[model samples]
Target: MTIPTDATPSGLGGSEPAVLSFQDLEVQFATDLGEVRAVNGISMEVHPGEVLAVVGESGSGKSVTSMTALGLLPKNARIGGVVRVTEKDVRQLDARRLRQMRGKDVAMVFQEPQTALNPVLTIGDQLVEALQLHGVAYGNAAKRRAADLLAAVGIPEPARRLKQYPHELSGGQRQRVVIAMALSCDPKVIIADEPTTALDVTVQADILDLLRSLKEKLNTGILLITHNMGVVADMADRVAVMYQGDVVEVGSAEQVLVYPQHEYTRRLLDAVPRLGAGRAQLGIAAEAPPIITDEVPALEVKNAVVEYHRLGKPSFRAAEDVSFTVHQGEIVGLVGESGSGKSTMAKCALGILPPTSGTVAVYGEDFNRLKRKDRKALQKRIGVVFQDPAASLNPRVPVGDIIAEPMVIHKVGTKTERQRRVYELLEAVELPRAAFNRFPHELSGGQRQRVSIARALSLDPELLVADEPTSALDVSVQASVLKMFMTLQAEFRFACLFVSHDLAVIDMLAHHVVVMENGRVVEQGLREQVLHEPREEYTKRLLAAAPVPNPEEQRRRREQRHAMLAAFGDKVVEIGDVPHGPEGP
Candidate 1:
């Protein structure tokens, strides 16, 4: 099933045979509510050496369609039509035969590698287990093969990594390990489900490069399932736009992304936040900068250095001389990679983690100098919105109670007053007042996050710390939330410290930007100065790694990134010159 290099990009009815194909696929799940039709007669295919991306928002049936291809749907699923992997019908295979077919014919790389991997097992153990399960190798032979797989995926010191547990590796390394396991048996096609969704921008670029390299080297087809339009631009040869259980549009990546025929596809593209677009692109009017005088800022950090004390080892420095200010009625975005101390700085600002040295001040009150009661009192004026709203809000508690709990703790008002405040907060966040009685799990991801925002604002805090608030949401929901956030901040005049890895998000919201790398602030200035015209190499690299939604623009950026990386003495992650994987000794 080899596709010619010059083959036509259109995938709907190609001349070359498909390595993976879905014919009139339909899936219905029998839930407590009734039968839910997840996929409706959607047909797609992945030719050898081609990347076919199935993209849509959450509950659009993209994931459901991919699940059917692997026969990974649950027992209650009522499936129709044919799913073929490597020209073999998946539904027709028996249990034992299905197990044999899975890793050999097709494989999957899940969104969260932490969940996909076994926590208790070493990396080598899991890799070896995968190899042995597919009868690829045995004992020491398997160990050698495992190391080779890791190296092939661009993980350095593969032999040393074999002994490390999942928790010991960084998010990027863990994803690489998962990818190694997927490539262990040398499947004909790989199903990657939002593989880079949880990664930092730089790490995501690396992983994308690795996947691209492997696809070319192994001549394997990839069925990429994701909601990120930038990733689709960077990866897909052909695109399938899924919406409410139907394939609304199918064409070459350029046609589908640039000149989308479907309304839903256009809407999806509209929702994507483009880098460097800033507030103007979102139709948010620019505000005059707040006047700064001798008056104290809302939150200030001066020469702050935070370190974690390890038992035998020297203290690990997380933030080194990190200094920044959030003025009244202003938003300052802290942008960086995962280990770059963005969250660490947020925690320190929230007073959850105290800096080992220097000072954190809130409106002229120094956190380190204040007495216990005084410090607690100062904290009353500060609000915090965490990244994942589901974890932040208590599942058993009603939304009203969750929002009013802060007011209750501070003893701000009577019970009746608190109820009134809760209703007001709900309206402020654009959630219906009826939502006050519902629990966290009963709401959608967007609604839950809105509840989290309401809870954070309950006490009418003058300062707000939002830590990756919209990272987990779908594009449209994120757009809605971001718009609401800007409006609320303007109305409330609250100074905010927004911590996120997304540069585009920061560009949309932040008046000032702080860029960090390896526990130090490399650049800080006005948003335009730092993001658009960055002077620091680290800042430039971070901006370069952030993908744009346009295919042509993204291709240009990718080329510039490679050139920049080479000039800066860095290398892109490519398949290493290791032993040819499953086919070789």
Candidate 2:
């Protein structure tokens, strides 16, 4: 059940209200420009036993405001607000007292578990100390609770996993462990900051359901921060739309999501790429004519099969009969779900892993049978863009030098020539000259991606291999980047192999579509043929699962639920039987 939004802002001090409320909150950071109001005057309340979703794009103060409530901001940061929790005003609380309250009264599950979790500590030790410090029973009590919490979060074989390190667990399992830790204290409030931002769709659905159920069962309030409206629609009881650090819209989930009143909210929703719906074209459009021949494709893969061989063991087939091509000046979109071996096919084309059989030829030169000099020459004509630009870029070096490195390595021109080219490349990526001097950490996620693109273009490659280039960016920024890619291809006439999990993006950028599943291509044809006129069950499932632009899709789900219950009589179906549930078969 949702809390009453019109509830008066009860004064903080004497007694605790439902839970952690931010009244007239304002957070600012001192910079050369001045005190940047990161979080403008905003008021929000997360009552006990409800999921309050805070939705916004980058620079929207979603993170900053949540960080303030937990007293997690830096010392230099100026915060003006009243944060109430555990019958105490947290904003004015002393450091030691606030420290005592955290992980007991409240806890947070961060976005990147790898970065948040201490790499050196084993999972058991981390959980044990976290529980013991909070005085949530000692020794075996804490261990037993930790194991139970793990299983509660759907982690398999908790006892065995306790000894395993963070690195040993996959991304999804690590997220589960993080969730387990969040619930260890049985905190009154849980702040999950973009908790499912990096997970796969199906995994994301599972995590959402897990959190929703946990919130209900434990009577814990949740301040869910995310940019995805689909996710917000699924789990939020109430939604607070933040723009320019201010809460522009705050209302029940049904009201805000179904009939968004604010222009900004509408724009934000509009910016979301509807994977199954959009333009009728291959979805990808080019401004200029393609620069390839009809006789031989720019890059051709013929019945390519790649295997990973371990000593004294049978080799595993990484990619089976994967065949596709990247024609010059045209884009080929390869779409798939997570763990579908999309990356393996990319690696094979890059020659990082040679295919066990079949042929890969670029511009009439065979890649598998090529020598070092020949392969190096081929590298000059192919560029790759990974999902996480921050990880790919060198932290120590500036953007200009990073971009110029590719040109310098290939010995394209003189020193002055290289410097001029770097400037031009930065300009092409729509980044300011000042960005040339800043390191990767100094820039935002979108800017870092632009730098990565600039570097990839420095070598003037004939083909670009982009893997989830826009997945990390905000929708508005993602759209702009897609347009930029189109413009770049039009100008340079370079072919692109765009790889993405989101079908809407693939449709908008790909001239043709190749759907991959279980390390093999299930469908490959014109974008319209593959996306709109599907011939496979998996393709239909992908389309049905795509993010809906309007709230009508939400209605469809409700109606579907109603129809299912109507047909199945009054017998209860397991929670896992629900479409978005864990066992959604």
Candidate 3:
């Protein structure tokens, strides 16, 4: 908890001049409901060669506060107080000067790189455009600088990558490209907003390392905005905790994260899922009774092999010889990094993707062999929850109808009966009955995910396949959803195939664990055997890469992971090595 003062570089402890500073800042929006206060009177500073992380939940003004520096807020937004960058007040800048200062004096790295970059443009084109916008370079000179920037960010084959489109690059690569663009003009201050949220653990670690190195090399101040405590622990030299549009706490990383003075900060840290903490520590109830009788397993996948055939390339196996099982009243966790075939296995089990070889059985019946009618009948007993509920739920449909669609398809009840079931489902998910009339967009991310869960369970299916259900949610929202899921599983006693990249969540919910890599099952066994005493080097690497909330522990883990990767050499699985399948590779 006590980080040595010497751990940070000299002159980084408030003695240096600030590159960016906010004084008595406040932001308000004019909405249909009324005037909404997004950011209250807040003051902070980002000093040269230091990371000042702003940690908060969604809608806590983290992004809004950062965006104000660039004048990125909507025209209708009302702002007050002073925001200074390099001794110049941003609010006082004209349109022309603001545009010039944006990428030159201050740059931003967005959360999702896919949306941040122009999809139609090549990576080189985007980088060149950024440089040319600030009058840094143009034409052949810009192209050369573009490739150099890519190389500086540790990307391989920089020139060839420049020729490729954004879609061609992996998530990690795209993020690096975004970082490259941000570095095109060598800005004095960088605002990174949830930079690694969509990445896998190994990729996240690499991105954090890249950011840290960039800060040191450029001596640029960084204002990091994120909801992830692990990211804050790993990157921040100082921490500021925001709650309900207010800065509730601010101190050194060790002081705030380890010995928080505010209750909100402590609660935020507690919401994080700690590695090896187990379900009891997270307040999850005991596991449901075992379904160990001599009966058919709830779901069984045997030596399954699934392949995708590209138009001009040779067919590749997405899942090769993968096998696992989930008994009634049990939860089997499918976990791995990106392109590890975890979701491919889940899809094969859900009968959404037919295997090239081997078999998938549901309640002792071969799913591939079932007739159309029989398959439809079998589907009535299955439910699924995907990662992004906003994408999964129909925005045009009401919540009640979405939940009742399953009953209607199966012709199991009359209209009145369906309405009753809808209410029951709403209650089961702990949603207000008034939500029945609301659309998916009208609710928060966590609320929409709960609605998705309610719809999935509407049919009272005996089996459920959840694919990274909590990955997109905030930590506190995720905790509530997880608790609800566990409670539902205990009540219904349905078998579950839970797919996720988060090891802490997997450890909490899964009775059995299955680890995959490059479409192959590297390890599978009871949770205690696989998690507590992992034998596979791959599993060890994964465990080592997962960040803890404690800054000191996370620092040690990072060092250990670096050493392990060094020892393993080329054996580690690189990101974007294979195409992620429908469920994800």
Choose the strongest candidate by lDDT.
1
Q: Write the per-residue lDDT of candidate 2 for residues 1-585, one digit (tens) a residue.
A: 123456322321113355778888888888666787888778878777778888877778888888876788876689886878757788877889887788878889997777778889988889878877766757776667677767777777989888889987866788888988887776789999888766655456557767877766666788998877777877777788888888888777777888899998887777776665544323345334554767567678889888888889998786789888878777888877766677777776676767789887777778767899988888898888877776789899988788888778788999899988988878776778888788887776667878888788888778788877776666666666677787777788888888786777886777788888888999889887998889986675555445444445754753454354456462211112111101110
Worst 10 residues of 3 by lDDT: 576-585
Clashes of 2: 4
TM-score of each: 0.89, 0.84, 0.88
Measured with C-alpha atoms, the lDDT of residue 75 in candidate 2 is 68
Q: Mind giving the per-residue lDDT tens digits that candidate 1 earns over 1-585?
A: 122334346543345678898888889989776998989887778888888898876678877888887788889999999999987899998889889988888999987788789999999999999888888888888999999989999898999999999988888899999888888888889999989877889999999999888778777899998877889999888888888888888877898899998998888888888777877766677663463535699889999999999899998999999998989988999988878998888988888898999888889887778889998898999999987676688989999999999998889999999999999889876678878888887675557878888889888788999987876566876787788788878878788999887888898889999988988999999998998899998998888998877789999999999999999999999877544445323
Lowest summed-lDDT stretch of 10 residues in model 1? 1-10
- lDDT, candidate 3, 270-385, per-residue tens: 88888787667578755445665467999888898999888999998999998888999989998888788877888887788899999899998787789999999888899998
**lDDT against the true structure, each candidate:** 0.85, 0.74, 0.83
| Local error of candidate 3 at residue 531 (angstroms) | 1.2
Q: Which stretches of candidate 2 lie over 4 Å from their true place?
A: 1-4, 7-18, 32-34, 119-122, 137-144, 280-295, 309-316, 413-433, 558-585
Model 1 misplaced stretches (Cα beyond 4 Å): 1-15, 288-294, 366-377, 388-460, 577-585
Name the runs in model 3 displaced over 4 angstroms. Answer: 1-10, 286-288, 389-455, 570-585
Instruction: List clashing residue pairs in candidate 3.
Output: 341-585
